[model samples]
Target: MDNKKVIIAGAGHGGLVAAAHLSANGFDVTVIERFAQGTLGYDWTDMFEKDCFDFCGIELPKNANYVKVPESVFVSPNKKTKIKTEVLSPITNVNMDRSAIYDSLIGFALEKGVKFEYETKIISPIVENNRVTGIFVEKNGKKETRKADLIIDAAGAFSPVRSLLPSNLMIENEFDNTQVFETFRAFYERDMTVTPPDTDWNVYFFHLDKPGISWYECREEYCDVLIGRFNKFGEQDIKQVIDDFKNEHPELTDKIIRGGQFAFIPVRRAVGKMVADGYAAVGDSAAMTVALIGSGIANSMIAGKMLADVVIENNGKTDVKTLWKYNVRYFKEINADICSLDKLREMLCTLGTDNLNFLLNKGVVKGEDITAAIKEGGIKLGIKDLIEKATKGISDIPLLLKVMKTLNEGEKLSKIALSIPEEYDENKVKMWLSEYNC
Candidate 1:
């Protein structure tokens, strides 16, 4: 048996990815999962499949749920624009069955000699000398202590390891209520055999003329369609909204036989720097969901890969100070541009449907324009200029200016937020945290 052991909490994609890498690196790895199997099965895009497959040297599953969506179409009440080309995004611009991807990772880890403890829940981190040595786990009505050279907290949003660490570990966090999203989605089998429109792998993003409410539609295999309504809306209202949308878009309704409904609540915060004291948190445990977009699959996989590298480089030895490099790489390399996108989302939230209509009427902001602007530089300064210029010769110019100023303040705050990297020195991190306003 390998003396160097790594214990991973959670059997999700992130945890499984980490386990696979560690096991391949000659570490005796054990994965603990709360759910037995088939728990987290969502028909969404699985960005890590290709990379994970390559890493594990295996073939991927081809199922209806695992169908790929090639491009995204941005739609408003009456407008629609499609992105023609496909980019190699970490989280692919594609969609798949999220659960199948999870299951695949688990199988890969198991084949790589990683042990699994299904129906197991991790209570807390077992710490000695302030270094995470292992975990206190409960399984099948039995409690036991398992020790490992390193512990990876791949647990979801609410991490068990966070409470054990200092609160200042994530002082630069700036997530607002608006960032959180409540969504209802359902998979429906189409009534007709005729192929659905935009059937060649297209995702529709409806910017609901309202603030905080947006929806997406994508075609799946076997005449199925994935309809998702995301934002701050009640379940009943969401169902009604979907119904109304179906009615409004007869072309969509024609192909659909019936629709089912479900809801998903997502976190909208920048990935927190919580890798400390011989412990590391990845996936939603680190609040790594994309702010405006709400994509986390790829981010979680990336974190898993990164954490594995950091652990390998350190040769199983880790501490608060030494683990800081992992956090640095997370924000700097993988998550830097995503944080900027979050700031843009905040700015857009302020510009609700009315502002969009106004921009459309004035011929100032178009979908193409916005896309080109973001691709050219970023949505920050370019949007501010457009908003300022559009409000010219109107009494609301002052109001626009005020809003722009506030929006600029938000941008500045975001800049400060992005600048707060995972610092190694406790004193330096504390000083920066104290200086940060949000």
Candidate 2:
């Protein structure tokens, strides 16, 4: 195969990982970050403990403060009951230094000969004869054009590639406006005097009565909190939320250390399709952030690996039909599961905090069991996964009926999603590509 020049835009978590994977495979990779060195790293290093180490196949320094949390507890404000479980392996929670991990990955990629340009902004995709040739970048008051065989869009939530295509352009369905939430997270020194009880190192998920406000904390010196706003909220709101949380949860208030402010992320699923003729997207750029709960690290890392494989397998092949296979496989293997989870989350959200609390406190509902069953294929998705997850614990006739109703709604949504496989005609696909519309 001819040597390939792969261009990765954005130096965020996913972008950096893609660069590392591609570089390891002998691709000539270039990573361009719009931000300075200190700002290029991600902010949530503490939430990911050992899981990241094994998942991404990276090692950490012995003195690293981040440790794995093997247990998880879910609490609902309105509900009297609480749910708890032991987290499985490969799903171990990790605590990390965002700057350290980012620097390590970037350095590893560099050691593998991956080239990088910091503070270089991608102005737009360079198109020639309707084919993507490279990109226009601006750096240090100089405008330069770099050519490449492929471009990976790993830019986070506010993706640069998003505007290059038509607004109506979609991968499977149009972008859904599910709302974005402002969130802040902090990492501190683990102070045994101020730590919460049962700190067997478990991740704590607090479900509030509010529509969007929710937070999670791992006892390992790092706390990640998110506040949902119906409309856009900023830094002030983040500070207020943190202050309120600290006051409300006094047990964790005293351990505060070197922390930072919150950032906004759309807690929505991705648009319909993920690829066009000459470009593709991964991570939050594709709106792959989970709904309800905002967890994208694992999903993005896995997507990076899958995308690398896709790009390597189809390098130099510019046809959309060949490249589009990435979409189908990704959708089937991962996105489809997320869609199901989104639907399930929508059901839970609509039920209100009262219902959630009642269900949690009054009955047996294991979130991990649901995810595990789905991953193990014990739960066939769409309506079936809901029925499986709901019925797995509920035995009362009233709750069983309610669970069945939920499953029915999920079934309806599944039918709608499944329609795409049949509705995807050549004209629609070609039209979406040629016209640059979703």
Estimate every model's Cα lDDT from 0 to 1: 0.58, 0.59
lDDT of 2 by residue, 45-136 (tens): 54543454455655555555555544555555653444564433435556556677776777767877788888898887776665567788
What local lDDT does model 2 show for residue 203? Answer: 28
TM-score of 1: 0.77
Measured against the true structure, the TM-scores of the candidates, in listed sequence, are 0.77, 0.76
- Give the poorly placed runs of model 1, Cα more than 4 Å off: 43-71, 77-93, 126-130, 142-146, 163-176, 193-211, 218-234, 251-269, 348-353, 356-365, 368-377, 380-388, 391-423, 433-437
**TM-score of predicted structure 2:** 0.76
Question: Which 10-residue window in model 2 sums to the lowest lDDT?
Answer: 372-381
* Alpha carbon lDDT at 75, candidate 1: 48
lDDT for 427 (candidate 1)? 70
Off by over 4 Å in 2: 24-26, 47-64, 87-93, 127-130, 141-145, 167-179, 188-195, 198-208, 216-231, 234-248, 254-256, 364-425, 428-438
Candidate 1: minimum summed lDDT over ten consecutive residues — where? 372-381
